[model samples]
Target: MILKRLIFALLIIFSFTSCTSDDDASTPDRRSIEDLETDFQALNLQQGINDVTLENLNGSSWNFRVIIPESASSTERPLVLTLHGAAGGDVDAHKNTACYAEPGFAALDPIIVSPNGGTQLWNSAFNQDLVIGLMYLTQKYLNVDRDRTVVTGYSNGGNGSWFYAEIYPEIFTASIPMASSYSTFSSNGSVRTIETPLYVIHGENDELFPLAETQEWVAATRDAGTNVTLEVAPGLTHYESCNYSPYLQNAASWLQDEVWD
Candidate 1:
């Protein structure tokens, strides 16, 4: 049953995810393509993304994707900011199946934002205020739960994934980093001891970085007595392993639908 489930999840991650881009479609979908362009212009409460111009502290103009949720009510939903891998700075990929966060996160409709690294690396690597700018924007435009904010990513973004979680543990309720090593504070591990909840995923058969790197990352948080969860996929490579839908399903299940009281 586990094997069958893994196969089904792999299929969804590869093909069955709900998001797609013109660059992703099997063929040129003129009608849906045109509709998408038109829809981007017409924004409703159903939630959409907005392009923002931001200048990092180092004077680099950072491109940002501010993803809103579907027609939500009562109060605004939580806010989650996603980072991308070194080669995958484009936000559209995150909005699509790869990151499993789109215009709509099914469980909880939070304000999701994805920031493009100015130079194939996070602003932190550039000694800038990009992340702080993100915090400012989150506070400025939305009424966040404060304790419910989340940071998640994979690979290069996975490095940034733990960066935010470590630096600002007070802001994030939970963090998930898939298929990336976690030592962000230089040669030493300073922020590894925060008490925030974390969900980590990786493949035992991953060839990118040894399983030890991921295990070390988790050990930091665990040694600090934080609420951390880790999952090791079997018989999968690094890229496709983290891309599996079941891993995303597990992540979404842990992250969404939490009451911030």
Candidate 2:
């Protein structure tokens, strides 16, 4: 009878051990923030543009340019995710002319990332997911100041900026959308109130997306209680993308002094 009791006790112990093992197998280990920062520092990324190709969360490949500032190692800097226009080829060239690369934006000492949108429009669900995944991955490896993150883009990329800021208000603090139309995302001429501030830059004589319509939409959005600012370039056209740099500098200044401050 003692042996029978011993066997029953062994069976119970075995069942308990099996259950513990099963629970352990189901739970995944999460690394601490300090550990993640240590891993990022270990990479020893150089100051300047680093061409990186990372696998997206969806198992697809994404090519992007990361511009690390000189003070990145010592200080936690703001992150700027700049998207290129629809004519997306050679992300490096796009980065060269974009406003974030200009001297004014550089003075902010922020880490800038320019991602290749490929042939697809940035407003599409697939590409939007890719943007979110990329931003998260960037945060995982870089010392990013979450409160000062900005999303800015041009033309089709501007459309993406608006869409992303609207959809993921918790991620971005401010948005600068240049040469874009609000009607692209909000077809019914309605603007959803979002917490992220918007600084829109558009050419006064935009041939493709009418400036008048954009002005109307901006007015309506302001009336709807969104913190928005619009800058109209006097004589610029939609295709003269390079000329928008000066305007972008103003937007960057506004972001640094007014919005982020």
Candidate 3:
């Protein structure tokens, strides 16, 4: 029995020593420039889109999906921001996106940001920190091409498209807000003064939002000194964005054509 107790005591001492050795030292996360550069080179961003989260002013968190195209290079690549509606959250809309989602993005590569609406509302109020939080989070990871930033959204997301674009016209090149309408002004309630390109799409048969909204958005943008294009899909309903099927395809193509410009 004595020998057994001694053996157990020895085992306990050895275990404690091993654990203490590990606890005695902690490594800092700081890395040298050369080390970081080496790590960056070893990293592969070609794994398609990724998931990211950010904290909001309300102490809540938001999720987003990022898609990077194979054609995208380290150079200034255009970034696409796709917003979701109130009923569906970020994940749902991210999956529904024609190109950034499944079989669509499996081939074509474009940087897409699908963010979760905190309250499912666009929160156009300049007081809200959502836009600033987004800009910070975006700059933190991916190298977004600011000069070519584009915003698009459906339903409530459409509000966000207009809110973000109008607020930061200098940061965005074009905006496509589908099936929705805004007051046609920047965040500060000032009329749009810059010349950001815009493409508006709406279904004439839309019941949730009148098809006339498409025309209204275009008119407002043009009147505000912004270049605008309008497309009204016939026989389409508000909830059913079937018309946007081709619209999304063209959106990708059109953006691709101008990414370099």
The best candidate in terms of TM-score: 2
Quote each prediction's TM-score: 0.68, 0.78, 0.66
Candidate ordering by lDDT (highest first):
2, 1, 3
Q: What is the lDDT of candidate 2?
A: 0.73
Regions of candidate 2 where Cα sits further than 4 Å from its true position = 1-44, 87-100, 184-191
Colliding pairs, model 1: 46-70
Better of 2 and 3 by TM-score: 2
Q: Write the per-residue lDDT of candidate 3 for residues 147-227, one digit (tens) a residue.
A: 566777877877677766665555566877777767665587665543566666777787887866557656766887777
List, residue by residue over 147-169, the lDDT tens digit for candidate 2: 78889888888888888788677
Kindly indicate the candidate among 2 and 3 with the higher lDDT.
2
Against the reference, the lDDT scores of all candidates come to: 0.59, 0.73, 0.57
RMSD of 2: 12.9
Candidate 3 Cα RMSD (Å): 16.0
TM-score of 1: 0.68
